[model samples]
Target: MSWGLAVLQHALRQPGCPLCRLQREAEARYLENLLWENVNDPATREQWAAGLGFCARHAWQLQRLEARRYGDGLGNAILYEDLLQRVIPVLEAMAREPAMDPLPLHRRLAHVLRLPRSGDPEGIPGLQGRARCRVCRLGEETARAYAEWLVEGLGDAEVRARYAASDGLCLPHLRMTLICARTRAPQALADLAGDAVRRLQRLLGALREYIRKHDWNYRHEPMSPEERRSWIRVVAFFVGEGEGDGSLDDRGG
Candidate 1:
């Protein structure tokens, strides 16, 4: 299927309900900006940070998106910090409330406490597994620091390269990538697994070279005709599969 036809099909498949359609459109716009905007731009960086610093559910979704692109678990840690900070105030306010049936708030608090915590530089131990709510303010500050890191870290080509160098993705991350990418490029998602396989191959090759060099080495490699053809075939499958098609719908995009 041609890209144009694929796009048209995707648009046609959009929900007929006015509110749902509008929400989907807005989400698409947001995702386009997130993927295409320069992370180095101050305003764009700030916007991205604020937009992504979501509640637990949305933060989990964002973390999944980052996991697919970066491969390493770094995005998970970053998002966990963001959620912890955001939940702190809400938890504190709840604490002040008369202690009647706090089940709903308790569930939220539990989610925050369940996050993986470690003393490793990469981990956020204070916020990750805390039983008490006292560290809520500290978590917020830590989240701000993480937001700054997100702005700075992603802009560093070396950091991005290092992230990509980690294991390409697990099954869960791959699924997250496909779902997040669908609104932006439905056709591309239709054949996501194949794309993932190819990407992993490319990264593996790069990793081999970087290991041999013992330095942060970068180079561009040319794809052979066969490789190009194979990729195009995968893309075509994604585009033509449409919504509710097993691979495109069930797995991710």
Candidate 2:
């Protein structure tokens, strides 16, 4: 099997949404790789600078991962310090902007008519970077690749059966898969959609059983493990599987 197909198949054997699990693992691996190897690489540093460091989620995630896994913050410190060094000049320029624009309306017009500000700072890059977060881009591209793989892989009866046996793709990934299916693998749409419908039906049954068991009279009845977690699964379906995943914004700022 292709590596991606193997990844999808293996993910299906695990708990929760396969795509979400893959994304989380992918992000961890990426950060670990950076900390273990690339933190000081010139090309890596250039990417960090362009990204202005990670988005809030990943910036903190880096720290958390470092502390929890390696108990060493050296790589994170180096990265943040470098990013800060690059960032200071931008904020300083933005701070200087108000002073440069201090002219009254008539004066500003006159100055504009004369010439552009002589010492305007080179494109004042901001905290709000035009560049997408490196981590976020990796997450997105990673998710997209896996989504396409899932959709196309479903063509195999064995892959389809494996997908059906698992918690299945989360809603966001379902959409991504559908998009991929609509264009590239129209035949697989039914396979994925049918699997989704079946899973949703199962969740609905479990949730209803869970709710019924909450009634005063039925409260004494024991709940199945599935029923107990049904509502949470529903919520996860709508909101995604993890923290900082609410938005599908490409820039992830």
Candidate 3:
């Protein structure tokens, strides 16, 4: 088996969503690689410039991982210093530009009321980073590729069994997996879909049990582990794994 698939199969034995876990690992790997090897590479810097040095989540993640892993923030400093240098000049130029006079009160009221704008109002300034975050892009590409692999992999009984042993794919990953399976391998999509449905049923049941047990009538009943985590697990599945949450290490990071 390919290394990724092997790793994915192993992940099937673990908790939470495999796709989410792998995606986080993929992003962390990219960030770690950047800090260790490519922080100063011209092409890497060019990509960073285009993205304006990462999205806020990843920008800080880069710094945090740099400090946590390396005991320093030198790499982040280099990247942001370059970005700040590019931005300060733009800010200074904006400061130098003549400011337009405020609109009349009636015109301001009109603008607020959604009438035509006045004074040739300009857009927010400074360099617009049209390029999406490289880390986000990589995460997406990795997830989709994994989704495809998962659908294709499901053809094997062993692979399907391995999948059945876990919490199954998240909604986003399931959609991507279904899409890939529909176009490329339609035979086994139902299995993955059924798995998702059954998992959802259990998740819903756990959530309901959790709510029921919260009532004073049922408060004496013991909470199962699944019941305990169903609320956050539901949120994780809905919002995706690491999109906003933080983490640390191979399991999360």
lDDT of 3 by residue, 152-220 (tens): 789889999999987677788888788889876767787877788898999999999999999999999
* Poorly placed runs, candidate 3 (over 4 Å): 98-127, 243-253
- Give all candidate RMSDs, comma-separated: 18.8, 7.6, 7.5
In the predicted model 2, the residue pairs found to clash are: none
lDDT of each: 0.40, 0.76, 0.75
Q: After superposition, how far is residue 193 of candidate 2 from its true place, in Å?
A: 1.0
Q: Please rank every candidate by TM-score, starting with the best.
A: 3, 2, 1
Query: What TM-score would each prediction reach against the true structure?
Result: 0.25, 0.80, 0.84
Give the local distance difference test score of model 1.
0.40
Give candidate 1's error at residue 93 in angstroms: 3.5
| Consecutive 10-residue window with the lowest summed lDDT within model 2 | 244-253
Candidate 1 residue lDDT tens string, 1-253? 4443333234324322111222234443443344445334555443433333444433444455556666655535643455557557545756687573454444544475433222334533333333322122223333333323322332345533443443223343345445555555554454445545776576456445544444434235544433433333243233322222332223321
Least well predicted 10-residue stretch by lDDT in candidate 3: 244-253
**TM-score preference between candidates 1 and 3, better one:** 3
Candidate 3 global lDDT: 0.75
Q: Identify the leading candidate in terms of TM-score.
A: 3
lDDT by residue (1-253, candidate 2, tens digit) is 9999998898888767778777877887888899989998998887777666878888898899899888888989898888676556544654666555332322343243321232223443244344668888888788899998888788899998888788777899888889989977877998888878988999899999999998999999998888877777788887578665332222121
